[model samples]
Target: MDEQGDPMPGATVKVKGNEGNGVLIGTVTGPDGKFSLNVPDRKVMLEVSFVGYVSRLIAASDTVSLKKVVLKEELKNIEEVVVTGYQRIDRKLFTGAAAVIKAEDAMVEGAIDVSRMLQGKAAGVQIQNVSGTFGASPKMRVRGASSINGNQKPLWVVDGLVLEDVVEVSADDLSSGDSETLISSAIAGLNADDIESFQILKDASATALYGARAMNGVVVI
Candidate 1:
């Protein structure tokens, strides 16, 4: 672990079976002090041992999937670090409403479009798929539409690049069946599988990053 009791980066991780004859698997933790290993589909007793910490044993079955595994620090005197806006703060020093959704929960919605899966998932943000057309994209608005002339659509940022004209398909196009009439003139393309997570920036404090462009809001994909 780190000096602050967090997972130590570059820490050596070793996994072995209860039987001494089993092969030894070795790996190093990342900067997040996290490591993942994929073993064969079989019943075995797995052991995780680090340099300075006590070894831990876990029973593994063919059907079991280890999604997240957290290792506890041996020392009890170290303090934990809390991440904040461009800074690391103590958890006891901050007050705010924050929610985190895992991959399992997001997949359970069975939504082909990422925007549709966000419905009823987050407050203040609204998602509407007004068309039943095959591969029809959804309409998303954070907080609410603020402008009449200017675009009400949120800014879509993929990776570190800001996607220009993210909302090319207007509501009128969907309603008037213009999108259906034109085979190759549909909306801008975006693959949902490429997205790791979606974050909606709402309220003035969150929307201030993009200046006036974020008056409507922003979506980080």
Candidate 2:
């Protein structure tokens, strides 16, 4: 029986050698999660894996029976994997705290500006909208402003590449500045549908890789 007390029918079962290299010898657990496969008389390893289920491996002996094997579903957290600097790591293994916001959640508040979508999405991050204009820009800060004279903006990285001097135009730019002037917009050019996930690195350990530029924070898109 599986964790839910239901039979794992059509569960894929594999037989492997001790070195973790082997073939897909056979499968087990039909609609009832029960099946059998013949193995050699030598000490060998057995691995069972199925979609939406956690894989399990066990050592089998000649006298072992293949009855009553249970398979359980894998429960994954949405924030389990975080973008750390230029790399990705399991959030539990990370030494610092970070927040992850999916594209779907970002659109929940009907936020047209990409930065506005991040408002209230993270615990420590703060987002301030420049205005209600159609092309207005939003300012983002992790924790709080850390620099007095230098730029307090966090570094932005998209698809593993560092984006330099990313700028956004405020509503004032549209009302007061030349109508033909095109202000730099960071999130305006990005396709929200194409975004897989975003990570806001606020802790020191998470931003340490970027050196002084990331002292305020880092945003990985």
Indicate which candidate wins on lDDT: 2
Off by over 4 Å in 1: 1-100, 108-110, 180-191
lDDT of 1 at 201: 57
List TM-scores for all candidates, in order: 0.49, 0.57
Residue-wise C-alpha lDDT for candidate 2, range 88-108, written one tens digit per residue:
677777777788888787775
TM-score computed on alpha carbons, candidate 1 = 0.49
Candidate 1 residue 79 Cα shift, in angstroms, is: 15
What candidate 2 gets wrong by more than 4 Å, as runs, is 1-79, 166-182
- Scored against the true structure, residue 87 in model 2 reaches a CA lDDT of 65
User: What's the true lDDT of residue 3 in model 2?
Assistant: 81
**Candidate 1 local lDDT, 1-221, one digit each (tens):** 43355666765555555347576666777887667666654456556556556566655552232333445556544243322233433445544332223334555445656556667666778887666665566667785767665557766555545666523556566555555523321123555555555555565554445666666666655
Lowest lDDT 10-mer window, candidate 1?
A: 180-189
lDDT of 2: 0.69
